[model samples]
Target: MSDAEKTVPESADAAAPESAPERQAPRTLTVRVHRCGPGGANARFDDFRLPVRPEDSVLDVLDRIRVETDPTLVYRHSCHHSSCGTCAMRINGRERLACITRMLALGTDVVTLEPLRALPLLGDLMVDMRPMFAHIGDDWGYVRPVEKASTGVPHGVARYTRLENCIECGACMSACPVSSGTDDMPPPEARRGGHEAPAQAAPGADVADAPQERMFMGPAPLAALNRELARHPEQREALLHIGKGPQGEKHCRRHLACSRACPSGVYPAKDIMDIRMMHGGGKD
Candidate 1:
């Protein structure tokens, strides 16, 4: 072929690859939600079937269902990026933040969602978060001195502070068997050593008549206490008193469920263990 013909300009689009195949239709998901009314009256399970894209999160599905399927289906959510922790729930029997939990990655056709236990359940998936916050207490500081060397403090600033990692999602509380009193955990006397068992209730007396005791203060609060202690050594004595109280780190039972359920990387179990070591509890 002549040089001119041989060198005929290549098509402008010749280098481009073939267009991608058509995207598949979204998959349908069966979301089974645990429902309850005020004071847990008329509790039931409601199933919602909807089409979901692979990237769709559990919160997204719930939003679609609420708008198109049922407006009355109630749940709490804010800041869908998982920072708010408002959408935390039991996803397929594990504590997870719905905002970040993708529907397709669950590897199941059906997704079961339930509210965090041990908190006062309101209608539908909503629960009273007040109790969880109460446990964390009012004095626990949310911000800490920034430690990264790359992010230097601005001039005239004594130090920089950033919000702590714990979002107070209550996932730790839900996952903690001791805090929720689920999983048929043995009594304190049975779990602890060198402690005398209390007198048992009379056989004939009504069980309801007996005074109920408070369980552990839970991983979130204990973790917060630890953080506070780390930030303020002057408060060590006061904070340690709380940590070593009746509802303290000693009752953790070392399940480590809180660490697994935490999406914020707080590692509450490790903090509890640290508190134990600090107090000479010796890692029981």
Candidate 2:
């Protein structure tokens, strides 16, 4: 053999560095997205395989699945960041902001995305927030603003400030089991109408406009009421009157799931505990 032909082809490793084992292709993430489309049977999970990078967000994977893979995958999302909370959903059995949940944090090749449980599913991953926020209003809703603007800082300013953090995203509602399934539960809109329902009945009446007055209130609105009650001690008696009955604090099962699912850390479980204290005559 010639000198060039006898060179042994550089031993394959010395010439090309062994090709680096094909670099593994960055891993494709498989997401099982629960979908409930119009006239669909019950709810079903649609599997989507997406190639994901380490820095990709859950929302990114979902979007890719929607656009590139399955156009039928339905979900709600506005801000790609965590500011909107519109993309909040249950990822891997935990409520999270899809925009902020990095793919690497899940530590799994398969990520399951579902709507916040309990609330009515609007479509694929969208759950109705109206009922959840309405749950709060059912328990005395908002302060009546005693005197337009009293106490130098405004009468209901402190109460409003604290409750304003609520994004009304239904994270707390999704976590609450009582309000989601049980009948005879009053939604928050029953207390404060026009925004959610626009035709809810008066606070104490079983008005024909809204039948939700008899249903149990969920955690989100109750949490807001708890914040309001924390501000105005005098409102406790009235709040208790509104918060009583099957639709009130009695519905909560002490699950503490509201606290766990809250993307903003509002702590609906703690709020419900405070409501219980007030109901028990701790303060008002």
Candidate 3:
């Protein structure tokens, strides 16, 4: 009613902090899935629009598509929990377990899904783990099992619980520059992950003998690290030598991608550092 009152109201509105506009949440999210024909051939992409649900996981949307839209769709998931290491794939350019990867947290309206790189692609989002597993050899050579009673963590052995632990998810390998173009790559049947290599490469490794340059066995070696630490004292030195040898730590590019992509917090880079520090590496 008064000019002074009107001016005061206008000044208050001008001085107030503009509440940062709340972002409008999407009602539906777009999922662009890399579809593979049987045996993971003829790779292609298909888009699916699904209703966004509260705390929706990437796996949740995929399950909905499989159950309601197309029964032919295939993917792998043993325990929907992160423990199984079954539902890992390239989601939005990062290798992560679908079960635990929240769709909303990605902060993107559209999410892209594809099989992990570096392993033989089986189909859709599935890759072969058998080839990778075969390298371990039959004698895991951990602590030899006793017929009578088995023991837990060995005394005086520093637990990898902090520095290095592996769940065999292969996500680290997927992100590693050293895990590609193996000189003696196992046959497809032996491996079932995507053949597409990651974008990065080790220094001087992008050219000829790309596979040969990779010294360590890549991120999967952490699993073997777990086992070796459990082996008898006599066997420990040999294992440490392998880590410091060619096809081991000497090839690491220090990219840090594998360590970052890991969902299990394995700290593979730290593991490499620990081995190098312990062995005082030298000429092979």
Q: How close is candidate 3 to the true structure, as a TM-score?
A: 0.67
TM-score of each predicted structure versus truth: 0.81, 0.65, 0.67
The residue-by-residue lDDT of candidate 3 on 39-105, one tens digit each, is 5579899999988665678898899899999887778888887877888899998999999988888
Tens-place lDDT per residue, model 1, 69-166, is 89998899999997888889999999999999999999899999998866668878887787667766597788997776576667998777788999
Distance from true location, Cα of 51 in model 2, Å: 1.0
Best by lDDT: 1
| lDDT digits (tens) for residues 45-130 of candidate 2 | 87877678777898888887778877877788897866566887888977788988998679988899888755566788887666
Misplaced by over 4 Å in model 2 are 1-25, 39-42, 138-163, 180-214, 231-234, 279-284
- lDDT, candidate 1, equals 0.79
How good is model 2 by TM-score?
0.65
